[model samples]
Target: MKQSLLAARYFNTTAEEAMDGLIASATPRQYLISVQDGTSLRVRIWSEIGLEEAQMGELLDWLRGVQGDIRSIQSGSTNAHDHASVVEKWVAERHGIADLFLEQLDPTTSSKADMEPELSLGVLGGRTVMISTNTLMFSRLQEGVFGLSIAQRGSYLIEQLRRA
Candidate 1:
């Protein structure tokens, strides 16, 4: 068995900015990127708000630039739920189906613990792209700001399944 290798790193930006930058520079082969928030405690208190639709569109456009076809955007965090709804509306308006993956987390928990590192992937018309996120920290590692760790985990998994 070939062990999967990950090229993970700590980014020096807010989670949103890191996500935006990754989406902007995405490649069709790169579907998911893990994000970590690396802001000071004070900055985090002020930057908890999520991204807007227009901002999402800008990010989507960036993804499209890299041959990425995003069918939907899902949020697994409470703070990002509203933003996910907004993005879903935008995608629906554009005739794309959007969904929020918020159900995966327990809502009763505090936002801090609930908003751990999340995994989201870009799908092209129902066909999932090869990508996913692992268990990781978002706030502490990234300083409570937006941070991202991109790896080819999905592709590796897919390849392994194919061989099996």
Candidate 2:
């Protein structure tokens, strides 16, 4: 029954404005915020947390509660938005596990030796789920400063899962 304030969502707001809202909603809790850029309806402020003191399976259950679908894009997966339906169907019907690995490559990094990559790790329906994104985009956890360890482990994990 314990959950952390992982995200404070406000569609179509700037990063600074999102921070202000986050401060108002959940003060004193340090949050890594991301704003979906451009003129479209963006997350004026979306946040996340990592390594909360919760049971292993609880995190996935919590994600389901908040991001069971697109309407619950308050937090959890980046798929909480546009990809909600696909993710929902996948989770509900237990469809092809081989189709889960996907990422949106930022055009800037489309041709680079080392790109701005972001990785997020979490449990989904008691399963270990991993996602990759650009560093400027959203993440599963509020871990901007802590990306190093997550990236290292994420790489290894993806490799292992691929082999499996």
Candidate 3:
């Protein structure tokens, strides 16, 4: 399969260091970084023709693999139960979609943003599935030190499939 790297970097470090760190850790075929307040980086590990292709639907199927319920943080102290249920329902419905990817953007250092979740959808194939939200969450966690940068390194597989 032809693979390209997608990466995003943040922080004061050089893009080379961040890219190297990601490649060294994950060893993926492709990499892409969405750096905030810094230059981004990308690398292609493999090249080939006629790789197995996928449509938007197929991408969605992969996303659905990690679908599940999420407990929401309490809202007000007096109506905590009601708010929790409401938030839980909202989250569940949001994830119920066929082809969606969600990432809780939380920076370890701290930031004003309330760690809002980032979501994306793959919509080419007939069988759409949601990608692993946990994976996206973890990726964001790793980039926490870099501020609010968004990284979609593992999504290369999905992107390749889409191209196919």
Best by TM-score: 1
Ranking by lDDT: 1, 3, 2
CA shift of 24, model 2, Å: 43
Whole-model lDDT values for every prediction: 0.27, 0.26, 0.27
TM-scores, all models, native as reference: 0.23, 0.22, 0.18
**Compared with the true structure, what per-residue lDDT tens digits does model 3 show for residues 55-125?**
22332343333233211211122232343232222223332233222232333425433443333322111
Report the Cα lDDT for candidate 2: 0.26
Worst 10 residues of 1 by lDDT: 153-162
Candidate 1, residue 39: lDDT: 21
| The best candidate in terms of lDDT | 1
> Going through the candidates in order, what is the number of backbone clashes in each?
13, 3, 30
User: Candidate 1, which segments miss by more than 4 Å at Cα?
Assistant: 7-109, 112-114, 135-164
Please provide the root mean square deviation of candidate 3 (C-alpha atoms, Å): 17.3
1 or 3, which is superior by TM-score?
1
Q: Rank the candidates by TM-score, best first.
A: 1, 2, 3
Superposed model 3: Cα runs more than 4 Å off: 1-54, 69-136, 140-164
Model 2, residue 134: C-alpha shift (Å):
7.6
The global Cα lDDT (0 to 1) of model 1 is 0.27
